[model samples]
Target: MEFHYHRTGPSPDLATIEQAIAQLDPAVLVDADDFARVRISTVLDEYALLDCLWRAGVQVAMGELERQPSVCCGGCGG
Candidate 1:
């Protein structure tokens, strides 16, 4: 959930990035660490995600961290 973007240059739009993140999230498993990283995107990647998570008292499962695949099966679980 580490985020990195140019500070001096045109920055990654926070809302856009967050919306993109939301669109990507299937079940909103945004752990505290990930959420903190989003909240602190300007300083993300520079600091460890786990550290942010720890400070925010959040937990995450390794497997659940990755983006879920797009469903082309029309919710049929194909």
Candidate 2:
């Protein structure tokens, strides 16, 4: 699973976001444009990661945390 985050105003520094991500350790920092996408394995991870971002003052857009299908290898049948 993946969580996408879009900030409303000036984006937080990369280090700030990186610190928040490290605390939860749920996902990998995938991509960043005006928004950020992270790949996580479980629903609980999603909640925890979001909480971490919020606590770190990320100011993520509400309802922007959409889940997308993860990349898969056919051999694993994920």
Candidate 3:
């Protein structure tokens, strides 16, 4: 799954966000666009991902959470 975080005000700490995501072992920070968005790939479900973010104090709007198409080779059923 890919997570896109939209910033509405002051930018949150990227390092902190990275750390938070790291807690979910399989989650990886695939890419990020300055402070406007973040793209993370993970095996964890959306609920788990969102809970982790919330617990770490990452505030994301309801609409900001998006599901992106996976860039897979279609060999592993990812």
In the range 1-78, model 2's lDDT, one tens digit per residue, is: 566665556656666766667665644464467334433343335567677668777665547676667655678554
Top TM-score prediction, candidate number: 3
lDDT of 3 by residue, 1-78 (tens): 666766667666666766777877545675567767777677776787777677768777556688788777789755
Which residue pairs come into collision in candidate 2? none
lDDT of 3: 0.70
Could you tell me how far off, in angstroms, the CA of residue 59 lies in candidate 1 after the best superposition? Answer: 30
User: lDDT of all the models against the reference?
Assistant: 0.35, 0.59, 0.70
Instruction: Tell me each candidate's TM-score.
Output: 0.26, 0.61, 0.72
Model 3, TM vs. native: 0.72
Query: Which scores better on lDDT, 2 or 3?
Result: 3
The model with the greater TM-score, 2 or 3, is 3
Candidate 2, overall lDDT?
0.59
